[model samples]
Target: MPIRYFIKQWLMPPGLLLLLLLGAWWLRKRRPRLALACFVAGLGGFWLMSLPLVVEQVARQLETEPPLSVQAWSGLAGRADAIVVLGAGRERGDLAWGGQDQPTGTALERMRFAAQLAKASGLPVLTSGGLHYGTPPSEARLMADRLRDDFGVVVKWQEEGSRTTWENAQMSAAVLQPLGIRRVVVVTQAWHMQRSRWSFEQAGFEVVPGPVGFLGQDHGRPFAGLLPDNRAIWQSGQLLNEVAGLVGYRLFY
Candidate 1:
C-alpha cells in the first residue's frame, strides 16, 4: 500500500481515535489524569462519529453544490461538451458475477447518475480511475462495463490510470483536451464535487458540477438522529476525508 494511505489511516479518525484509546490503556496506572483525558477524547470522538446529526451537520458544511433539477438533465449538452464520471473505488471480486471486480456502491452511484445525464443529453461519457491496488481491470474499465451492460449508455473514453482526484482531472484532460473537448460535466458525490471541480478547473476545463448522493438532508431517525448508528461512523469518515482532500489539494496540487 502507499505510504500516504498509511498516514491517512493513522492520522484520520477511527484510527486516530483507536490510538488514543490504546494510549489511555497503556497509561492508566502511570499517568492516571492524562490517561483519563485520552480515554474521554477517544470515546467522545467515536460517539460523535456514530451520531447521524453530526454527520448531517458536517456534510451540510461540505456539500456545497446542489443537485441538478430533473428538467435540467436533458439540457446538459448546451452547457458542456461531455460527461466525466470520477470513479470512487472498486470491489476486488465476488462470485456473484463470476468473480469479476465490480464498481463499489459509491462508484455505482456515480455511474447511475452519469447514465441518466448521458441518456438525457446524448453527450459522450468519460470514466476516469486507476487500477485496483496496481492490478488489472482498472476502476475506469469497471465503471465503463457497468454503464454499458446495466445502464445501456456507452463510454466514449476511459482514462484508466488515475488514483487521486487531481490525477482524474489531469489524466482526463490528457485524453479529452487533445480531441478539442474542453468543457465537461463532472459527476461525483456532493461533498466531493468542490475539490473535483477545483482540480478539473485547474486542469483547464470549463466545468459543470453534476453532484449526487447528498448526505446532508434529514435522517428522520428516532430522537432526530441523536441515536448512534454504525453507518454514521462511515459517513463521518467520508466527510472528514473530503475536508482533508480539499485542503491537501490546495496545498500540494
Candidate 2:
C-alpha cells in the first residue's frame, strides 16, 4: 500500500506543481526573475511531458481497421471463446437506490463492442469490473445485464475487486481459469490495448487484441486533425500512467 501510494504521488501532475511552487518561493527575493524562471520551468515541464506526441505515437502503433464487420462477428456465432470487455469509467446513480440505477460510461462502449464481437463470433461474453466507488451494481453485472437486454448476447461475469490494471488481470484470470477460458478476444480502446494485452498475458491468458475507438486518424477532414486538440493531453496522461503501471507491476507484483 505504501509503495502504491508513493508511485501514485510520483506520477501525478500535482507533484510537479509542488516542485514549481517550492522553487518559486526560494527565489522570492528576486521577484521578477523568480516569476520568469517559474513560468519558463512550468512550460518546460509541460513540453517535456509531451503527452500528445506520446499518445499519437502509441495510437499510431496500435491502430487497426475495425475488425470483423457486423456480418463477420455474426458468422462466428458458435465457435469462439468469450468476448472479454474491460471497464474504464463510471457514472452516478440514485444514492437512495444504492447505485442500482446509475448510468455507466465506458462500460457501455465495451459492451457495445462486445455485442458486435459476440454476434460475429457467436460466443458468450465476459464482462470484467468491480465497484470502486458508490453502491451501484458491480460494473461486470451492469454490463452483463446490458448485454442480455440490449444485444441479446449471453454473458458471464467476472466482478473484479481490483481498482487498478494489475488487479483487473489477477481477478479476471481467476474467474476465467475455473471455466477453462484460456484464449480471449480483448476489447478496449486502442490506446489501452498495449497495457491491457501485457497485463493479461502476464496473468497467463492468451489474448487476441480486439481494440476499438482509435484516436489517431480523421477519415473525412484530415487537415483538421493535424492540429492537436485538448484530448491530446488526456491521451498523454493515459499513456504515461500505463507505462508507469507496467513498470510498477514488474517491480512489485
Candidate 3:
C-alpha cells in the first residue's frame, strides 16, 4: 500500500538477495561477467546473514542494555510511575483467532515482560501504538486487550496515535506530561532499548530502561551456530531495521 513499505521490503534480504539471484540466472548466458558478479553478491549476502552467530554479533551493537537483577525486579515500587510498552506491528486477520488482528510476537514478548514488571512494581501500564495503514483497532487497543485478558493488567492509558518510537515518546509525553508524570519505565526489546531511551528522553521523560528478550548472548548451540537458518535471516533483518532507524532518527529527529 505504502511506497516506502515496498521500497523497504525490496531492499531487505530475501527480496533484494532473491532478486539478484534471479537476475544472475536470467543473464548468465549473454552477460556472463555481470551475472557472475550478481550471483556472488546475492549468494554471499544471503549466506553471511543466515548464520546464528553472525546475527548475535551484529545485534550486540544495540543490545547493550541488560536485564534487571532478581533483587531489583523483586522490589520495583517507587522506581517509576508507569510502564510504557511499545507496540510491534500486528498480525493481519487470521482464521485461527476469528479474523481479529493479534499482537505480533515481539509485541507479546514486550507485554510479557511488562506484565511481570507491573505485577512486581505495583505500577499501571500504558500501551502506545497507532493504526496499521490507517486501519481501525489500533495496535494500542490490541495490546491493551492482551495485557488485560492475558496478563491481568489493566492498561491505564492508551496512547493510540504513535507509529514510530519518536511518536511513542512524544504522544505518550502529551498524555503523561499533562498529568505531571515525567518519570516512566519504558519496556521493549533489549536491541530496541537504546533508541527508545534516546527518543523518550528527547520528549522529556526520565527513562528507566526495562529491556527484555536479551539477544547476542552466546548459546553454544553446536553446529547450529554456523549453519544457515530461516529464523536467523529474520532476526538479522530485525537488527538491520533497528540500525537503519537509529541512523535515520539521529539524522532527522
Candidate 4:
C-alpha cells in the first residue's frame, strides 16, 4: 500500500479516534487531566460520528446538487451528448458470484441511475473508473458488465485508466473529445457531484450533473434519529472524506 493511504487512514476518523484513546491510556498515570481530555474527545467524536442525525445534517450541506426530476429524464438528450457513470469501487471475489469481483453498492447506484437516464434519453453511455489497487478487471469493466447483465444497457465507452475524480475527467475526455463528444451527463453520488463537475469542466467538457443516492433526508429511525447506528459511521466517514477531497483539490489541483 502507498504511504498516502496510511497517512489518510490515520488522519481520518476511527483511526484518529483510536489514537486519542491510546493517548488517554498512555497518559492516565502521568498526565491525568490531559488523559481525561483525550478520552472524552475520542469517545465524544465516536458518539457524534455514529449518530444518524449528524450524518444527515453534514451530508445535507455537502449534497447541494438537487436530483434530476423524472419529468426531465427524457429531455436529457437535448442537454448533453452522453451519460457517464463514475465508478465507486468494487467488492472483491465472493462465493455467491463465482468468485468474480462485483461493483460496490455505490457503483451499482450510479449504474442503475445511469441506465434509466440512458434509456430515457436514448443517449450512449460511458463507464469511468480504473483498476482497484492495480488489480485486473477495472471498475469500468465491472460496471459495464453489470449494466449489460442487470440493466440491459450496453456501454458505448469505457474509460478504464482513471483512479481519481480528476483522472476520470481527463481520461474520459481523452476518449470522448476525440469522437466530437464534448457535452456529457455525469452520474455519481449526490455528495460527489460537485467535485466531479468541477473536474470534468476543467478537462474541457460541458457537464450536466446527474446526482443519485442522496443521504440528506429523513430516515424516521427510532428516537427521531438521535440513536446511534453503525451505518452512520460509514456515511459520516464518506462525507468527511469528501470534505477532505474538496479541500485537497483546491490546494493541489
lDDT per residue as tens, model 4, 153-249: 9999999999999999999999999999999999999999889999999999999899998888898878978998999999988999999899999
lDDT of 3: 0.90
**Would you list the C-alpha lDDT of every candidate in the order shown?**
0.95, 0.68, 0.90, 0.94
Tens digit of lDDT per residue, candidate 2, span 1-253? Answer: 6686687765464455556766777777778697668767766655544445545665675554354455556555343466778877566665864755533555677778888787766676777777746455677777777688887887866555766666677788888878988787788877677778788888888877777777655434344444444666556566666666656777986
| Backbone clashes (count) for model 2 | 10
TM-scores, each model vs. reference: 0.98, 0.75, 0.93, 0.98
Best by lDDT: 1
Task: Tell me the tens digit of each residue's lDDT in model 1 across 12-122.
Answer: 999999999999999999999999999999999999999999999999998888889999999999999999999998888768999988999999999999999999999
Report the Cα lDDT for residue 249, model 3. 94
Local error of candidate 2 at residue 212 (angstroms): 1.1
Ranking by lDDT: 1, 4, 3, 2
RMSD of each: 0.8, 4.2, 1.7, 0.9
- Pairs that collide in candidate 4 are none
lDDT of 1 at 41: 100
TM-score of 2: 0.75
User: Candidate 4: how large is its RMSD?
Assistant: 0.9
- Report the lDDT tens digits of candidate 3 across residue range 1-253: 4988899898877689999999999999999999999999999989988999888899888988777776776466677788899999899896799998999999999999999888888888999999986898999999999999999999999999998999999999999999988899999999999999999999999988899887688877568589888888888888888998999999999
What is the Å distance of residue 43 in model 1 from its true position?
0.3
User: Candidate 1: where are CA atoms >4 Å away?
Assistant: none
